[model samples]
Target chain A: MLKKGGFVLSAGLVVLLMVALIYQIKNKYYLDILFMTFFWASLAAAWNISGGYAGQFSLGHAAYVGIGAYSTALLYINFHVSPWIGMVVGGLFSALLALFIGVITVKVRGPFYTLITIAVAELLYISAIQLKELTHGSEGVSLPFKPGWVNMTFRERETYVVLALLFVALIYFITKTMERRRIGYYLIAIRENEDAARALGVPVKEMKLLATVLSAFLTAVGGAIYAMYIMFIEPDSVLSFAFSIQPALMSIIGGLGTSLGPLIGSFVLSPLDMFLRESFSHINGLNLLIYGFLLVLFVLFWPEGLWPNAVRVYRKWRSGGVETKS
Target chain B: MLLQLTVSGILLGGIYALIAVGLTLIFGVMRIVNFTHGDLVMLGMYLTYLLYKGFGLDPYISLFIVPLALFLIGVLIQKLVVQRVVGRPHEVQIFATVGLSMMLSNAVLAYFKGDYRSVQTTYSTDTIQIGPVFLGVPQIVAFGISAVITLVLFLFLKFTYTGKAIRATTQNRISATLMGIDVRRVYTMTFAIGSALAGIAAVLLMPLYPTYPSIGEAYLLIAFVVVVLGGLGSIPGALVGALIIGVVETVSAYYLGSGWKQAAYFVIFILVLIMRPQGLFGQRGAEQL
Candidate 1:
């Protein structure tokens, strides 16, 4: 984590980069790519809270995201409640719902736990589809696209990017703080060995639930922002298994449980996803095929993920360990 | 109507049982939940689709060929990918198969373009009427095939030396190794056997259902429910669990809307987890709390 002064410096540098990036974006597409990178970075960090820090491999985060997205979208479309308020309600609602699920499956661990998480996500997806009057029966809901600050919609794409960057930065600070505090230690202890941690009076259930709530709330907030940015929402589009899996995939690829991992992962992967979308538009499944191959390769060989592994290699090379060893 | 649903559920249950048995076998022996087990099932279905499409090979005939081929694939997967994640954390193991699942399904999507495909056969629409109930011919055939294969598998595990070795290894990996059993080979073999069972299931299911890449996601959920409902590692348990799920699915779909069918089983799955994580047939000590 950046120290207090380093944090300020990094913040300033990020602001500078933001200005340069905004100035450099000549068209909507590049702006979109930048918007998506920060957008994905925020979501991945939200996932890292529960999956990475708390050590619960939740493959069903789309449930919370969908809940959040739908809560804000539906309220805005139907009731005309400002999404700013809707986002908070949605985030809090998702947290409560996650708590209910946690009550049911908190004692469960391992693959069984993963299965339950998936089941819950699928349950919500089905619910979203079935509740046609509310969710529109897969027809999806869309905002009015009213260009106003209250609606969270903006005339300028740069505003979205700036908002996304702020989201990422906010979640990053929370993660960094939690990682150094008692909550983070308790979570890691529970993750490393729940039984041992419980024996040591770590309050495993409460800690796990707390981490899950925070994670789910942040993810929902991102979902709300995403809905505003995209101005459209659907069950399959938002709550699909792929949406659920992507966060897990990103955290794993970047370095599961690390503060910088998700940021680094999204910074690397979002561009690749965009590039694939650009170049492989004609191809059917090439993008996912490549992602799968890359994921499997990483799981087998580079389980430490990308960023840390790169850091290790760089440090070794700089210290001349390679030459000495050779 | 009740009889019809019961009959159909059991028939469909046979297919579910076949898939779940393979999944439970892998989980039982290796303690690695093969999330890709359903993908293997999907792959098997595609293989059948391709064979029937290209060579005019009957799916029934392909059943013999498919399982053998799938066995080889399963063995390779266990050796190359699954083995590496065996002793690792749950996250690694889950993601490893999750990645494989993504890879296999997406590869199919890329190549097949997500069009739902089905084989045309004389018996595809044929059904037999018996005492106010109708049974689809292909469904009967699938049920028959699943039962025969399951019986054969049960006998193999009961009597055959290799099958017994697999069972012993499942019971205690280190002890089985200490007793000079080739534990590694046994794991590989179990995985192969499991995959073969999934292949047989896919072949049986092809006549009744259409093939698509993401179809695995549907069956994978069923397999999970069945694996947990039936005790992990117990073949009979998987069979029993599959039948229960099949009946529950058809009944709920009949009474409730079709969209809510999955939610019904998911409720049962969660209930089972909370009330009895050991499952209906699972021994008390089988699962770690």
Candidate 2:
């Protein structure tokens, strides 16, 4: 009961922080950072469903992201459809693709699955680049700037922050709901040991497919928002391996398989990434070097991530009299 | 033209075989897929390039020095980094190697500035024509050297006492250890040998592909596809897989436009993966075993 209360309080505090952030939207840079951070957090959280919960290490998540971005952008550009409607269509399309990939590849466990995902992502990226007439190839596609509710555009940054926050909150609540359900338990069981889970009567393949489809859908939604926010979408920018790596990095660094991990990871890493972009533009690849080194260090030393440690601290404070050992 | 493409594909497959062998060697021995295997090859290429460009040594000659140096580095890395995380969870292994790959590639980028560099050898322009196809002398030389090295390595694994022990360890580490085969030593040696082969492949490929930090990613993806398509932990499988990939890629580039070549190969790669998850040469139940 106490743990549940603490969780609710912590979530409330996060909401309060988000509300405070909206008041600071006068600063466009700060608002942009918040939007990007939440965008990444949403994607990372979505990634954790399949990668962390289901334990399928997919390195090609950018495929779904690209699919969502391009699908919605194309609809908006060509058919004059509202982005709101396009987002749903794009998400479902990406989810279908994920389901297809999951059905074929999930039978193979471990590194083989990872290899297949990488291959699939690479193949998709190459196809997108080659199909220049449809995707605009390397040149990318641009959405016109129109101010309206249906278009999801605003002259001020506050609107974006509110929308992104809503997304983050929706995803967070969905994941929380999932964690309480039988599906989440099945995913965790499969993640721990597929054979054991199968023996326990869990439909491993179906559960994994569900996770992948849901993950793809959420990721696609995030991608759609991102395209709208940036007002431009390109194959290289959307489908690159670097973009695929981001969610993994964020999820792993923040805390895998936990509700708060993606949020924590985004808060910690996104700012550093922004800083690197700002400071090391001239250094070519030094920032990537630092990023890679940090990932290695985190893997070696703190695989449980920062949130677990923070949880311990919070628990200790709540105990009131004596600090408990983590 | 067809005959030429076939010959060139075969020669290119030789180099691919060499690179994939290193990756398979480590997998065969340790049952751990080294994600950084491609980066190690990239490092080998850079080391070979530096030796030639800075010290005025021929790339072929530097091959002897580079592999030995890389072997030592590999041994050290295995002992210090890889060994520490050997028995941990799967995520740890993936993250460690993935992290290592990222670090190595980015470090190279920081140092080399992403320039495409190739060893300017005298034989670079020299080509020999046979029938309809003209083949570069350097590529032919690389093919021959790679074949010779692969043959020698095969002989060593088949004949040498230590080589037999490595193979035994690869098949069953616990049984090998129970039989007093010193599995630790086998792992170290396997890592060194695998890295050494990567080093050799780098030198052989440097004359053709040019050296760049991100070049590893391009080859890494291909090597990974070859490794998977061939079956993990199978050397001969790597060779066959490489040949198939090389032929497919070359043919696609010839028939389809160059732009569609990658797409065509990737389609084939995904189709094969979906159809035959265990690969053509991979032993059934070997993954679980």
Highest DockQ: which candidate?
A: 1
Best by TM-score: 1
Give the TM-scores of the predictions, in the order they appear.
Answer: 0.97, 0.95
Residue B9 error for model 2, in Å?
A: 0.6
Looking at candidate 2 chain A, the ten consecutive residues that score lowest on lDDT are A1-10
lDDT of 1 by residue, A61-173 (tens): 89988988999999998899999999999999989988987888766787877888899999999999999987996899978978898988899998999899989988998
User: How high is the CA lDDT of each candidate model?
Assistant: 0.89, 0.84
Each prediction's fraction of true contacts recovered = 0.73, 0.67
Residue-wise C-alpha lDDT for candidate 2, range B162-228, written one tens digit per residue: 9999999988889999999988888999999988988998998888878888777777767877877
lDDT of 2 by residue, A174-293 (tens): 888799899889999998989999999999999999999999999898989889899888887889887677788888889888888988898888888878877888777776677778
DockQ list for all candidates: 0.73, 0.66
lDDT of 2: 0.84
Clash pairs for candidate 1: A285-B110
Error of 1 at A88 (Å): 0.9
Candidate 1 stretches with Cα past 4 Å from truth are A318-326, B285-289
